[model samples]
Target: MVSLIIFSILSLDTILNVPELKNAHYGICFLDLKNDSIIYDYNSEKLFVPASNMKIITTAASFYFLGKEFRYKTNFYLRGTIKDRKLYGDIILQGGGDPYFNLENLERFADKIISMGINEITGGLLIIDDYFTDERLPAGWSWHYLDAKYAPEISALSFNKNVVSVRMRPTNAGELANVYIYPSTGYVKLINRMTTTTNSENIIIYRKPEENTIIVDGMINIKNARDIDVAVKDPAMFAGEYLKERLNARNIKVSNPVARIRTYELFLRQKQPVLIDSVLSPNLLEIIKETNTESENLYAEILLKTLGAYRYKEGSFNAGLNAVKEFLNICRVDTQNISLWDGSGLSKHNLISPAVLIAVLKFIYNSNLYYDFYNSLPQPGKGTLKARFNGFSDTLRAKTGALQASSCLSGYIKINGQDYAFSMLFNNFVCPIKKIMQIQERIIRAFYEEMRRTNVDNTELLKPVEVIQQ
Candidate 1:
């Protein structure tokens, strides 16, 4: 009995004295599912800016509402008649905002079109992108992001998420040459004379597009640039132009020059979307893994917008937010203190508390999707958290959130061989970000050390004791 009493006192002290956690503007909470325990909690209920941790809530709602098996589809339909392999009318390409559409897929589509045997078209190409209810971009999305490839505007009739790729290569003796686009689309015409000096970081920039112009600026290492193809702006136009070029290569001729044509009708000659090839993405389970482990902005955006498109009966950002709200209400998550403006948590207005986050995790754990949900998080000391707790065991699995003045870590931890769910968030800290990171690391390490000294047998009595009375 004496040992029990002493251990209890020590555990309580350790819980309250978590390093760098005291009086923090942020909040931290720990819940042990195995024993129904709240091992340690400080300001767990206090509201704080959660940053990308916001992805946790958005992703959970998305998984619940969007279903795991859902795959976005882009369709090609023709309105006019096809006579003797010749399209007498216009061909229509309808978009369903497939975020994963790529050049390869587009080319396969073109190949299918070529296989149809119609070499000439009397009418032009028409595109319909009105799948979503709204055309205005997400509120508070930075203008700078408009031009950046990752934050490409959400479009229902999206092709390659409305992005293109331009590459540069260096040849022998300090001269640079034009690089080839994988699915060469003439939507963008390159006039780059920029050269890269040896032993220097390559510079590349995207110029603002003119009324039908996509410009690329900057220099790239000829060798390194050849490795990976980055996303470009205006993927639809690029894709359309590329298809035109490939058709021309096959002796197919278009009556009109390639241009952006926004029409709901498709030329009858190209009504059939012949399936030339198909590329399946990593499953929803795998996608969530990439988002959590790599904190990929692109994936998060895709999933969020995907959620919006699925819910609210429309595939727009507002629709997605409506779906999120409905899912939270259904799950009984407390949203009084939560506010979100974007799915990626890139917006500063997004805010959440440690308690709310833990609540979300707990709710998901108890839900029917528990298995797929749990596996989506990074393995402790492995994926995102690999470098986090250096000295601690590889038992911490959590989502990390980072911004200029904000840092957050929330998820589950297995302390002293005992499993626990936890959340630690810091925001508006005046201290240097380096120091805050140091504090964050120390706090995680302390949880393990404290758990090691406590008795797993008496975890019940110690559960509620961790949450201090406000």
Candidate 2:
């Protein structure tokens, strides 16, 4: 059992010197908010894989480039005239890169069409998805994660975050397990070879690349139910099919199947489209809140592309990365030490120093968007910190990130009614992640306990104590 001495002083240096962190490549920086002073630092200039901590940078850049009130607008248009309650023109669904577009929004669009007294559409549904590049996946993403819900395909037109849930229920031993897909859409086909077994559960779900054929093969115990969320192969087509279904469900007769085209092809048709209705996404601030609070990969990626679309008129990964770089320059970050490959730190290619993250947090703290950005981070017992920092609720707000062997926590912590920004990143550690997390918490607790002692001198509190490693 581990023993602790209450009177013994603790600091970041002492906490990290233990055997638990001997093999980890890590960096840390703690900055006092009031004086903009560096209270403590260890390997702060070294580059490390940031994991979801990269969202801090993405969130800052998004607020800088796309204001708090920015919203994605998806418009519907009619290319043909309506006569005798029958529309003779095609209904165009133009995508505006709305990441939150869902079935409810589609239903609203259908209802709006019905309100226009249009029962029949003589032309096919034209889906315009050229606002972003055709590349669905970003660079440096692992091939193994392509089918995961967290790594869903990015598209200008997305439905339900481009993922579908597959629920598997076990019956009896030696029998096939029952499988059900959510949204009840025929967008993908599933081949279920899952068997109910008397032993422990061992299930595997795989979706073929660029294809909608998902294979469920494995054995599940009779006592358990497995639910897996798989990414869709094509987001734009998925949206088109789902939208068509929604329109048909509302008794709207669509004459032809949906066809997807780029802006160039639509302009060549020589027919001007008239606007009918549109859907607006939640503002940028709310989206960033979700992105940072939940460490959502899809939202971060969408915001990156949206930035690209706004700045360069090209919604591609390279353009979005360029926009982020520009924002970093404005923040006066040392870009030479950072290598950002994707908006979401799912890419192992993303390397950033703790000092860089401190720079971003400092910039946000001093900017006009400080409150909005600060409030976006999750407090203890909320979001990603839901299970962490018990009893430290209002005093701590942070972002947590983990990717395989990488782990990080960064944000603000209050001590004696004073707020301070800090970042702790650990990468390529052979030790169990739980141990690393405990060490991180210990470091935080050390700072909290040491700095909060009213009678202790500032210099004495900052002194590091020698820790004996087990």
| Top-lDDT candidate index | 2
Off by over 4 Å in 1: 1-24, 134-136, 170-183, 189-193, 198-204, 209-234, 257-283, 380-394, 415-418, 430-438, 453-470
Q: Write the per-residue lDDT of candidate 2 for residues 1-470, one digit (tens) a residue.
A: 54311123345557778886777799887887877766776777899999999999888899998899999988887887889989887888888989999888887878878999998999988898889999988999999989999999998988899999999999889999998788878888899999999998889899998798889999999999888899998888888888788888888899998899887665566677878789899999999999999888999998888889989999999999999999888878877768999898999999998888888888888889988998899888889888889988978878889999999999988888677899999998988888888888998898888778864444566644333233
Model 1 lDDT per residue over 1-470, tens place: 12211113244355445544444577777777776656666667777878788778777886787667666667665445668888776555665656666666766767776877878777766555666644535676666556565466565555664655555566543665455444455565555555654555456545464333334344555455542334455455555666667777888777886545443323333453332344455457767777777676666766777776666556667667777777777767666657777777777777777877887888887778766766677665777666666755456667888776788888776666666777888887666666666666666676566666767564534433332222
lDDT of each: 0.64, 0.86
lDDT of 2 at 127: 93
TM-score of each: 0.79, 0.93
